[model samples]
Target: MDKLTKGTWILNTTKHIVDVAQKSTELNYFETTALAGKTGVFLSKLVADKQEVITYEKVKKFARESSIDNNNRNVKMHLDLLKEYGKVDYNTKLTEVEVYCFSNEDAIETTADIYSNEIVDEDEDINIYSLEETYNVPRKREELVNKLVNNGYSEEKVNLAIKIQDTFGLIKVADNILYNEYTFTGNEAKMVKTISNISSSKKKDIEEVINRISNNQGLIENKITSDINPEIVKLMEGIGLIDGITVTSEIGEATFYTSPHIKGKGIKEKDFSLADDVFHKAKILLSCLRFGQEKSTYGRGKIDTRTKMLNIIRKLNRGEWLNPCTAVGQDYKLLEVDGVVRVRAFGNRFQMSLRQKEVGILVEKMILNNSIDTTDDMGDICSLEVQPSGIIIPEVRRQQMKPKEIGLVKELRDEMLTILRT
Candidate 1:
């Protein structure tokens, strides 16, 4: 086979392995971390050999040689971002995800600093900050509020500040701890409703946390990422074997540790060769096992519906409602956001919205029940707790079209239709 065709076949092969590995890891937490760390090193070496810049073609070449599939998208995405944003100051606005994806430490730090910057008090603004900065400032809103009170910021002001911070950005709070980062004109509340981390005040013992998480059904599934198990890490660290070290995460009674082993020589091992080996081994082992597991067990979706519903509400602060699938196309194009949204991939396919789906089901229910006798009363939501199938068709009357219904449907239909077109 020629080079291009050979590379495509190689990528196709790698994708299958990755898909299987993602599925089987039950307690495969340690493995993925090792995989990431090792992969980072491997990529870095390749970059170093090429004088520090890996183009899309080079990455494709590497993808073929390395037998890894995920980097394909990362390479393209990073190149696009670098082309668009260029080299910028390190800030927290960019996520760890974007950081690792790009293999750009400067970019990662720029984004990190942006996210980690402290929240300002009520009065401050007119500075340019990212939605990332806003969402992450009040990361642990309740805890930050409590911390503010401890800082003598006053319970009344601190609580109110946190509430606003949760909805607004860090710059918007009237009183900010990040005084150094000031602008001429104060324009706080830069963005609204961004995904930031949550801080939990109620510290649970490892045993307590594990028990709580285990018993909470979908609560653990929804709130906790499969990649993490904090309780497990704590337990492992508490054990005497590994010491004088650092840990990145602990999930479900599993702990990840990395530290140089001290020897008789005052300056023991400075290199992380041992740690590197261990990490890669853990990753491959986990990858194999995770690849072996059943889909239902691995998937978070199989959790108890009630628990899933409750946890999602608490986590996202909103209930999920599915709009009925009036048209279930062979292809689904999910609408991630409205307005000018950046999408790496776009095409005709199935569309989905978490809470929006419920509305469609309610509409379908009205139609199926024959409650909607006329087209003018076409606005419907089909809530199907009763039906197992996800086929939620709206109850709009096909018999006749009211002027108002036609206009409304035209607008709404276009919205859904736009996603399908893409």
Candidate 2:
């Protein structure tokens, strides 16, 4: 009972009930119920203060001292009323009492706000930029901006840095700087070396020019007179060393590199355009099929096989020829003639002919067979209609398909079919 004296009244209603009960000559039934409600509130606060179990004897004693009804019947009746209103634990026995906290809607909302404010205050003190200073980076974009600004970097610089981070990747940039190495190869290497010999002031100019180029979508006037050495620019333009970038005396245009390009060569100059197109199509089709398969119950080995096939296609598109051992569960020989690359399958179980042709058909057939094999029915896809885009395999009809799966199937099927025909 002494423990209740230390408890703070969180709700103002507790005071109002006491004042009204004191002023009234005699409390009616309604006033008695109100007094019980106030007692319940006090009991909850007392439990919160104790931070331990409250016994029925202690609660009953506290109620008597507080000038409320001390009779066992009245106390039990009020306790049951509190339980009915969800103010206290409904399962609380007569011997033991457990106060339910934040039981009121208002109390729950107020508690939530208090917790939210505490989290915000703690976050405000954290410096989330400059991993060297903070030891961690903020995951949120707004916090990242604030942290960079606090680290003495201008907003423009922070914006540009974020763009670079997004483009080349933060880890890649860090690796290059830490290792004191360049990722550029072939003609790009030469350009880097040439730029390295420039004066410090000129380097700053080049940096500004690059920033402008990035911001303007690769279109900018050659304004950096000192930074951009005319001789180096002319040399780069003459040798076709710059890919996805063009510089004129009046205007310079730049584009991000989506596909790998060799120095001194453009994508149009390569004779593997047909193979490239077919390979891209096959990749899309396979990716769609893999997505569909993942929604259903798929074996881990089948997923691994699908991922391997995608990697092979990506490597081939990057101008790297694959040996038979590099392929997944199949033997392949990559042959390049007159800049046209063709993949020939050796020991192919399905195709009898050993003749080497375009890699598109081989890839398509390999993926199709692999997909069919993983399914329960061996000939399930055999009856599927082959359209110009690709084969339309029926989806496994099951209640397990979620809304997300439905959307994925529709999108992949549409894109896959479109690419297969082309």
Candidate 3:
């Protein structure tokens, strides 16, 4: 793991449930904050009203107006969560208790300053902020505690510091293993929280395995799950962090664990600059790769439908024409209806191939690389979600092609086809 510098951890901001739901459009500051529920609304008001310095009495008033639980304890708990996020600075030692809200950057800097100011004499060297540098890699809690104790800090102080940082979401403890929460981003934070809340003895083992696999990418399922606990692999797959796909060829069958995040290495921007029909067909195939039914007439009873689909995609990628009646059967019909494959009359038999070769290559890259960007032209999302059984079910949405863009696509397609035929 790379070492992190203090105040330079590049912390990722968490999305409230509302933010995730309404991320399609730009939101004003107040709307963004208010939609996060009472805490967001409270922070919005504090910032909007220039309440840089606040009091507990004023906090209670805001809580009542915002329809929060509004009790002395609940309000303070909310305040603490906000303080941990570096959204507010509250002085615990003051007689009157002051809460300060600075600009986004200043709030974090101020929080670090506040923590630094409150440290005891013996704990001058290693504070919560400096801990980011050391705890970049996940470690068992006892291991971390022992490491810190060996460095001269009291066990009591080390534990207290860990708890405080955990409360702020800076450090996360899952399965009794301490993880730097800054290591996760976007929906990954939700996965971390889910892991934290679940009751399991295998979580520590799961983290270790994930750490190992992350270091060595492109391992097969058997290689990963053979020695480790099956339940742990199932849980990790269920949470959508790790996934595997079984691909079949004439030679044999093997399953490879693929990264959920796709890189789209061989795909280019011009690949999407083709005809709208080609783009739309590619979009359907990508969606089918994620949302299509898992069991079908073509695949074996025990094999996954995705594996069957990938086999067809692999054949198409090789430019071999398939006969709908003999070679691919009903699978071709399903993809034809989905607009991902083209079925046309060839001599005396019906033939099927991908709608466009370029589009087929795009799908191939998506499967091979694991991450591709189609948000602009295809409206297909790169993120994935899986059931506890490890079946992927990504959200589906389609964008309508603009009239002007449609003509451009047609012109480009004609030009490319003419050049290729020559």
Candidate 4:
């Protein structure tokens, strides 16, 4: 099998790759995924600016602007990394480059909607579970196509839908079989029912809070009342519908809450053991993102630092620990003086983790307090099932969020917005 070269740093600077990958620092399990994230922001901007098929030189210029490893060689490596992750489409021949565009596409009813609604609205005798089973069970790609076609969808449209969903990482097609990764089961299915059962009297307020947290990643616990009634929050918590992870620092501590369905990566319901490491790693990544924005990493310039930071944060997956070198390269030492991050030696090399774990939740609170907008890339590790109307299981959606559903989350200022606010 051919070896992978994109996600790691090639130490042999003398050797250029897209050609060879000898003597590389592999990022397979050691948490260097942030480099691809950083590179994604660059690709987003490059596509936005060029607005057409880009050239090789444009990619190089953007790479040079990055604060993370801006060498000529690293540019090629970063592009390859993004390509592997579905962020860009570059021609290896180096003439025409097509990057994944970040612009929002108009909301049109999707093929899932078209087909699923056709069956249900028409009152077909087909057992819905049978239809769902057809989708959930891994089957030959040809079989699924024939099923969709037999159900009356044009073969061409069905093929296009499969292609689009595949590209969006919503499904996986391998060896002629289709696997839908967005299939909701276990706790995720339970969440759909929980959210659906919210009392109409409180639905307006509660769904607002739940939807906001689900969209913006999560919220600090004490801040929940600012958006909804305290009694409502208590009820939700009592029912195991919502929970939090508390992070501490020398100064204080704060608990961030969200439905278990939308909590950041690695955090699980009833899984307190992972919260410490998960939030701690989130803190380091958040701090490093802040540092990058302040230093104009990716050219954020004199814009709102919190918003800019969130933009890059949205591009990143919070669960992946930042590479120690990547952290230090972002000048994490400056943050250490402020007690934001901690650095220590491990074996022959150094390791970094967030000392001010409170900073992660605090920054999230700040963004809420200031009314900063979270971009489409809200950076939450989990995907919410956000279909407007459909059978919840077979047509479950992921990653995509509707604008009206994204409410502005608020922070508890002076602890005045406590759960007893009403």
Please identify model 4 stretches exceeding 4 Å from their true place: 1-186, 198-200, 262-307, 310-422
- Model 4, position 139, has a per-residue lDDT of 50
Instruction: Estimate, for each residue in 117-154, the C-alpha lDDT of model 1 and write its tens digit.
Output: 32422211111122122222422345445555564556
| Candidate 1 regions with alpha-carbon error over 4 angstroms | 1-50, 53-77, 85-104, 110-143, 146-256, 260-422
- How does candidate 2 score on lDDT? 0.31
Off by more than 4 A, model 2: 1-33, 49-52, 90-93, 102-422
Tens-place lDDT per residue, model 4, 154-255, is 677666656544543334454455543222221454445445654345557666766666644435555567757766665444233454444333334444
- lDDT-better candidate, 1 vs 3: 3
lDDT for 35 (candidate 1)? 32
lDDT of 2 by residue, 1-422 (tens): 01111111112112223434455532231233244335544443333311234567766765663445768787776676555544455343577766654322222233223222332321111211222221121134545566667766676666554443333222112211210011121123333444455443335544444333322221212433245654433222222222122211112221221111121112122332211321122232332233323322233222223445444444444444443421222211111110123334445421111111233343434343322122232211100011112211111101112223234333332232222222
RMSD of each: 25.2, 30.0, 22.2, 19.0
- What's the lDDT for candidate 3? 0.42
Scored against the true structure, residue 342 in model 3 reaches a CA lDDT of 51
For model 3, residues 194-280, the per-residue Cα lDDT tens digits are 445434455566566655544433344566777886555543443234544443333333444433333244644343211122112
Best by lDDT: 3
**Model 2: worst 10 consecutive residues (lDDT sum):** 379-388
